[model samples]
Target: MPTDISRLVHNVNEQGFTALEKTGLRGQQDQGLVSTLISRDLSGSDDLCVSWGRILPGQHHLCHHHPDASEFYVVISGAPLVHLGDTDYRAKPGDGIYIPRGTTHGITNDGDEDVNLVVGVSKPADWQFVADE
Candidate 1:
C-alpha cells in the first residue's frame, strides 16, 4: 500500500530533509543562526512545536521566556552555554535541557564550532480548568 505524501512532506532533498536555511524559520536568516521548523505545521502534531536550531561561534539566542509553554533543547553537536533563568549549563552532545513555562532561557555558542540543537516546545492544552462538582 502506498501512502500519499503530497501534503505530509513539505521539502525533500537528497539528504531527505530540508536544509535549515531553506525553511525560513526564525534564526535561519539571522547572522550566525540557523533553524528549521519540524513540528506542528510539518507533521500536524498537536502536542509539539519543534525545530532544529544552530548557533555559530560567538552567537546566541537572547534570553526570553513564554508564559504558556515549556521547552526542551537537546544538544545535537558542540558544547554550548545554555541559560535557564539564573542557572547556566555547558551542555554537550546528547544532553537535554528542559525549561519550564515562563522561565527565561537561551543558548550561546562560545566555541569555534557551531552548536546544533533539537528544540521543542509544548503546545497549548486542549483541556480547560473546571470548577469542582
Candidate 2:
C-alpha cells in the first residue's frame, strides 16, 4: 500500500513537536517570560503553526520578524505593548493585531500583571531571520 503524499494525518498530539522556549533563544526566560504552548508542523496542516506565550511584568520579547509568514496575535489576558515596525500599539484582552509577512514586530509586558496571548502563523517560521535589532 502506498500512502498519498497529499493526504495528511490529522492527530492532535501526534505531529512533530518542539517547544519554542527550549530552543535557547534570547526570549526564553524563566520567571517573567515563557513560551508555554506550541503546535508546529501540525499533523495535517503544513501551512499553519500556533503558539501561546505569557510575559510577566518588566519582561520583553526581543524584536524579530518572519520573512516567510504572516502572523496574528490574539490577546487573552492583561495588556501588553506591541511593536510593529516603527510603531507601538497597546493590545488588551480580546484585541488582535495583524502583522504582515516580512514586517518586524515584538511584544513586551509593561503592566503589573502577566500578559498572555496566542500567536498564529500562516507558515512555518525560519528562526534564522529573527534579529535582535
Candidate 3:
C-alpha cells in the first residue's frame, strides 16, 4: 500500500463506517500473514492507527519492529504468543501487551483456532515491517 498519509483519511462520514466483514484483509501474505479488521486510514486518523488483527491457527505473525512508533496489542480471543525483546509472553483474552518504539516483537497463534487481537500504534507514518532476527 502507499505510504502517503493523505490517502488515509477515509472517515465515518466518507464511507469508512463499517465492520470487519466490510473491510478486506491486510498484511503480507507470504510472511506477515494476518487480516486487519480496522485501521486509522479507514477512520480518518493520521497520528495514530488502530486495527483488529486475526491470525489463523498454527500461524505466526513474524517478528518485526516499528522503528519510530510504539505499538500495543490487546488479546481478544485465543492465546497469542507475543515475543518481546528477549522474552516471550503468552497473552490470552483481556491481556494487554506493549512494545516500545524500535523494540523487536511479533505474535504467533499456536492454538487450534484463530487468535484475535486489538492492535494500536502511534505515528502511523513511521510504521515499518522488519524481520525478527
Candidate 4:
C-alpha cells in the first residue's frame, strides 16, 4: 500500500481525520461502537496503525482477537472494563492497555460517559478479528 509522499505529513488542524469503517460487532450492526482511523498504510507508514475509538455509554463489545497485530489502547477518558485473556480490569484515564497478538480481548463502557481510547497496532495490516466463542 504505497501512498503519495508529496503530501505525506498529517495534522489534526489541516485536514479532517478519517473514520474507521463501522464494521458491526461480529457482523451485527448498531452496536454503538465507534472506531476512527488515524493512521495506516495510506498515511505512508507501513509499520503501524492508529485509531481513535470509543464505546457508547453502557455498551459492551464481544470478545475478539487479532491474529497479526499486538493491540494497545491508551485510555483517554472514562472507565472501560477491559477483558484480556481470562482476566478483566477496570481501565482509567492515562492507563495503557496491552493485548498481545492472538490474545482474546474485548471492552465495555459501563460508566456514565463514553469510554474514549487511542488505539494502536504494531503493524499496518487489516484487522483480523476472531470471535471468542
Candidate 5:
C-alpha cells in the first residue's frame, strides 16, 4: 500500500518517524476498532506491520487469526478482555501480550476508559488473515 501523505503531519518529515495514521491492513477487523498503522512492509524494508489501536469503552470485537505470522498486542492504558486461542484473559496496562501464528485472537473493552493498545504482525506482507468464526 502506498503511503498517503494527507494523514501525515509535519512530524513525519521533520523527524525520522513514520506515519502512524495509516489504517486497515489486517482483515480480522471489528468495525469499531480504531487503528493507526505505524509501519508496514509497503517500502519493502518493513518485516513487521505495527499499529496504534484503540477499543472504545464497551466494545467487543470478534476474533481473527494470522495464518503465517506471529502477532502481539501491548496494552498502553486501560485493561481489555483479551482473547487468544480459545481462552479469555484480563489484560492490564503495560502488558505485552503475545499470540503465536494461527491463534485466534480478539479484544474487548468493558472498562469506562478506552483501551489504548499497540498491535503488530510479523511479516505482514506474507501473512494471511483469517476472520475466525
Candidate 6:
C-alpha cells in the first residue's frame, strides 16, 4: 500500500540543545540540530524514504555518505550552505541538490531564518552503514 505523504505521521520535539530547541543550529554546530523523520518505507518499497528537516542558524549536518542510495534534497525555505564531495553550494527556496551514491555531503544553516529541506532517498536506508563522520 502506498502511504500518502500528506497524511503520514508527523511530530516536532525539542532537541535538548537550547539553540536547536529554539530556532536551530548555526554553521558547523548544526550536526545535532532538529531532525524530523517524516516518512519511511510504509509502502514496502524497499527502495525509498522521504524526510523533511529543518536546520537553525549556525547549525550543520556532519560529513556523511550513503553507500547504496543516491539522495536528493529540495530546499523549501531559507538559504543554507551545502557541501557535496569537494564542492560547496548555496541552497535556497526552489533549489534542489542531488548527491550521488557513496559521496560525502553535509549541510549548514548559517543564515538568520530556519532552513527547511525535503529529502528523498533512492533506497531504504541501511542504518548500520550510516555513520556520522
Output the better candidate (1/3) by lDDT: 3
TM-score against native, each model: 0.70, 0.69, 0.70, 0.76, 0.71, 0.69
Clashing pairs in model 1?
none
Relative to the true structure, how large is the alpha-carbon lDDT of every model? 0.65, 0.68, 0.67, 0.73, 0.70, 0.67
Model 5 regions more than 4 Å off = 1-29, 41-44
Judged by lDDT, which candidate is best? 4
Instruction: Flag the better candidate by lDDT, 2 or 4.
Output: 4
Per-residue lDDT tens digits of candidate 5, residues 1-133? 9887643422323333232222244633353454435444333336777666767787766677878899898999998999888799999998999999989987888889988777788874656766775
Q: What C-alpha lDDT does candidate 3 achieve relative to the native structure?
A: 0.67
Model 4 TM: 0.76
What's the distance in Å from true for residue 86, model 1?
0.5
- Can you tell me which runs of candidate 3 are displaced by over 4 Å? 1-40
Residue 118 deviation, candidate 3, in Å? 0.5
**Candidate 1 overall Cα lDDT vs. reference?**
0.65
lDDT of 1 at 26: 42
- For model 2, the local distance difference test gives 0.68
Error of 2 at 14 (Å): 15
Show how many residue pairs clash in every candidate, following the order shown.
Answer: 0, 0, 0, 1, 0, 11
- For candidate 3, the TM-score is 0.70
Overlapping backbone residue pairs in candidate 3 total: 0
Q: Once model 3 is optimally superposed onto the true structure by TM-score, how far is the C-alpha of residue 26 displaced, in angstroms?
A: 21
Please tell me which predicted candidate would have the highest TM-score against the true structure. 4
User: lDDT tens string, model 4, 57-90?
Assistant: 8777677788888999999999988999999999
